[model samples]
Target chain A: MYGWIWRRLPGNAWVRAVISLVLILAVVYVLFQYVFPWAEPLLPFGDVTVDGASAGAGAGREEGAAR
Target chain B: MPVRLVIRTFSELCITVGAVIVLFVVYVLYWTGVKAADASDGEIHRLQDQWSRGRIELPAPGATASAAPPDATQEPQKSQAPQATRGAPTAPTTRSAPAASAGTEPARRPARSTAPAARPPAYRDGKPFAVMYVPRFGRAWDWPVLEGTGVNTLKKGLGHYPGTAALGGRGNFAVAGHRRTYGDPFKDVPLLRPGDAVVLTDGASWFTYRVDRRAYRTVPTDIGVIDPVPEKSGFRVPGRYLTLTTCEPEWGSSHRLIVWARLEATRPVTDGKPPALRS
Candidate 1:
């Protein structure tokens, strides 16, 4: 993905380098400001608790009570 | 020849340094967000599946229908006919007929009781127990609220402070999310104005809270903002409160930004939609 972006830039080595940096920063800014937050609900990264315990345990307890 | 060789080596060094800097930037700003988003997406799917499969145990009165023990089949009967004699005081036929009819009436009311018993589940650290919605941020401004404020949970979405009050409860329900990285869930929180609705749902009911105050600069050690009655929130007595905290300056965490909201209304999920989401 990044290679495609880099190859699409229009510049010599020095100019390309500067443009690439700016482009990269702009992409990062947009991701932080809009894209990532919008996609947060779809991620699976935060299922574990900080106490070294998994949420599944509480879920299991609820299940047991429920059953 | 020697001078030419040195010149060539100097240019190579510059190229290598520049490449290293560019790679570092990609790693920090791009790669991390990608990984965090992927993780958050997985959790969301799992949560939705659990809800769909009836794994989430509704609290109390609602619990009996889906959670009754095998040996306690009589419990539902008891709830259905509260006036029925335990030891057959009256004619079984005459009493049970009316009790059966009365039982269905209370069953309908349990759906409403669901709200008061809809205490946020005691989820494991990073698991989502509720989803937050801020119409002030637009219709797409919703994120799953994980159970605890651990590093892992914050990376996925908003993390609920462990010691704070439960969502829509009679105390402060404090949460924290990233301001810049790890999906930047609170990136636009600063734009929220007073009276803006900050709503959340736990699959049972919608809890709408109205933003009443915003604090732009607060020290990391300031716990008063998450207090039951948040300082500077303009509230003197205890009430349902929602406190949202994120890093300040949009790029740094030298200080914190706090937004305080008061619970305004709660509607059951079966009620179709809350006013905050009507538009």
Candidate 2:
């Protein structure tokens, strides 16, 4: 019965739909949930947060010089 | 096949970016570790010993008279300015120490050397430089008495020389330090009046540089401050000069406050050479 239901769904369309859901979930859980809290301890006053690329540049590289 | 290739390329791009991020973090951690290690070496400890106390009986003010850590292995110095944290150069820079915490300090601009006096100051006995005193800032400011160009020894206290003279192989031997911070070794440096003396020792010989003139000047990174004739030559002639530099405007200077002295005379370090420094 389950196989029949899954089989009824369009393969490519369902696959696309599932990927879209996973992407959205990743954004919410990984970025919003985990990242925001991780940064809160470093500089509490500033509300805006830098992404992985920008923070990596600041923490690891020289401030103004190019990579 | 084309779609699969596109996804693979994107994933590869992400991996490359991640690798770069890891490498950068490692670099910062390495330098921070190195700088920390350099600060506590025996040289610095010896310098601190020299600065902490002195035995020479200096003449009272106005008269040509005399003067005067720990490391967590990893953490970069939090309290000091970047220059303050760095060790002395093999040959230090001119010791400009730019005002910005992160921006580079321009090296001291060299003025022409003054003509050598009847008796050019010589390193007597074994002493190279003498301990000059700064009265106001109190205890923290004592420095070593270096013989020729002071840039190398100044690193023991001033951090690194910002430009040329720091190399220690050249014309005028220049020295530098902080004003109010870094123990404010040079905080009262700007207050030095004419006739004040900077004595240098080579252990056996002592040389004195007199506070002949003082001025304020702007310095650019490329400008060499300790050239044979480091200063601008207009009415002045050339010879060996000693310039003391620190921040301007007393408490703080957006620009440099400079005190230029000519080599005057030197005394020999005698059998009873008391500490040449005082707190």
Candidate 3:
């Protein structure tokens, strides 16, 4: 797949390399600023701590305290 | 170009875009936290400077003694006045005589009653109002509580929900922060057990809240957790409540993690550190 793109380039190696780099950066910038934030609500990718840990850790202290 | 060559080129472009998307996720989840932490730290330092400059004040420890004589008409209600003074000094008074005189009148009223009356420091959208210390998170865990939850405000620190009760006021004082990105101010929120103290100081007094319960799951649209009488907060009446909320599951905003704490004590900053903060 990559070989085909390299062959289709209008210029030599350096020009193709520059074009590739620019395209990659543009793609990254658009995704970072627009696409990702828009899709964030639909993604399930932010939790760093394990689930149920707070409940388990807080249970004993909660019971010990009188409401 | 040949059909096979065109197909190959398109596939290659797809692969590159796919890789870029993956990198974008990393930038959002990790890089933003790094940048937000730097911004939040800068805000925290600025607020600390403001506090140190005497812009915020707790009433002078003995101001009430002199205040009693001037407001003699309030003598019947004087007993409860000292308690209000215990938490706030009734705006910064430059003159000792005037401060004492002013203190007596407000002291006669309830702290919550006078809090809203005093002109609170004009909090700009991204400005810090108070500094929150969650000892349960760490000895060094502190975040500047900013005025609003706008995107710019969250980048700096925890954002105070607009239209909610002011800190230490009569209604629910609520704040929202990022759970994972944006410095992860509430990253360890789940570790807060019942009875854990969440202390906030706006340079005048320390308002300590005792965590009553932790609501592990609430839908993203659940605004009830921030209500004056928050649903599932274990409170039945209107009172001073502090609601700390963050995105749940550490990585996603599929739900919210809500922690409810009731105002347990309000002490003048002059009284030294509250016991919950005794290191």
Candidate 4:
């Protein structure tokens, strides 16, 4: 399995730790790969959507938004 | 010396050294892409603010064309808004400073004529932001944070959470990344059930949000999915809320995945040690 390969093809634990850290961030990215198109409809949330872009006051800042 | 004493000393040293090294690496990476990253960070912060507020009065409509910032303390002039030239040109000029404030502080740009057509602005201010990393996936391509509209940035972090909304002027903080395949930042996003933690930090504050509930609402029909006020926003305003969204499997999941979280706690991010990031 890929897990076995990963464990075997390693340097010292420090290098592995860094690699593991990267792996973790990658998994976080996977969540992004989904439902963008669907969620987009809510984009303007409550605004004037003229030609696929948002226009208005609030400008649409949400939670985890500024992240 | 007692083994316990020696072990404790060693562990503390390791942690200190580890923290130093992490800080060092973060500094280097930041230096390499300070302008872009910090701009994006500012944009995020700005939108986060806008979620509750509005454009903080535009600075003298037309200041100038363009210039560079000189001091380390003064805010970077529209530091992150330059990227706006492409996306939303309606950006107001402002100043920002990086959170690092270490090494060469992120230089500030001089105020310029608010370009009519701005590019996708990055962060609205300079806030030390850590890259969102997820384990259990590939090593080469950890998701990168971008400066622009919230949805796009969320995509860089992962894919858009199917049901959540992006940070902007909206009430609820909705984020989306990816699920499975191609640098899956939110691969386990579906795994996040209610009561689980969805952490968001800007290398400044670690905001802990507890997942309360998750449901699949047809993206277009789900108005209250992100209800910022949580009371209405039903063609009316509402209290604030949080939503984590993304695709289901990978292939064909018409059903949008949504995970709801409530603000539980917040703590400032250490100098360079931003708490681990999650979607």
- For every model in order, the TM-score on chain A comes to 0.48, 0.37, 0.55, 0.39
Q: Per-residue lDDT for B1-279 in model 3, tens only?
A: 689788877888898778877787787778777777788788878876665444542332223333233233223234235434444433222212222333333222223434442222356666887889999999988889987665556667887766667787777888877787767788888888999999887755667898997655777655666777876777998878888877777876567788889888765543445678876
- Which 10 residues in a row give candidate 2 chain B its minimum summed lDDT? B88-97
Model 4: runs farther than 4 Å from truth?
A: A1-67, B1-155, B159-170, B215-217, B220-223, B230-240, B271-279
Please state the CAPRI-style docking class of candidate 2: incorrect
Report the Cα RMSD per candidate: 12.1, 18.9, 10.4, 19.3
Q: CA lDDT of B29 in candidate 3?
A: 76
* All candidates: DockQ: 0.04, 0.03, 0.10, 0.03
Candidate that scores best on TM-score: 3
TM-score of every model versus the real structure: 0.63, 0.37, 0.67, 0.36
lDDT for each residue of candidate 2 in B129-190, tens digit (9 for 90 to 100): 33444433344334543322222233224422223222112245555544432233565665
Error of 2 at B103 (Å): 53
| Full ranking by DockQ | 3, 1, 4, 2
lDDT of 4 at B92: 25
Best model number under DockQ: 3
Model 1 achieves a DockQ score of 0.04
Better of 1 and 2 by lDDT: 1
Greater-DockQ candidate between 1 and 2: 1
Ranking the candidates on TM-score from highest down gives 3, 1, 2, 4
Give interface RMSD for all predictions.
10.8, 18.0, 11.4, 15.7
lDDT of 1 by residue, B86-148 (tens): 211111111123334342222211112233433544666667877788887778666888876
Q: Candidate 1: which stretches are off by over 4 Å?
A: A1-67, B1-14, B57-121
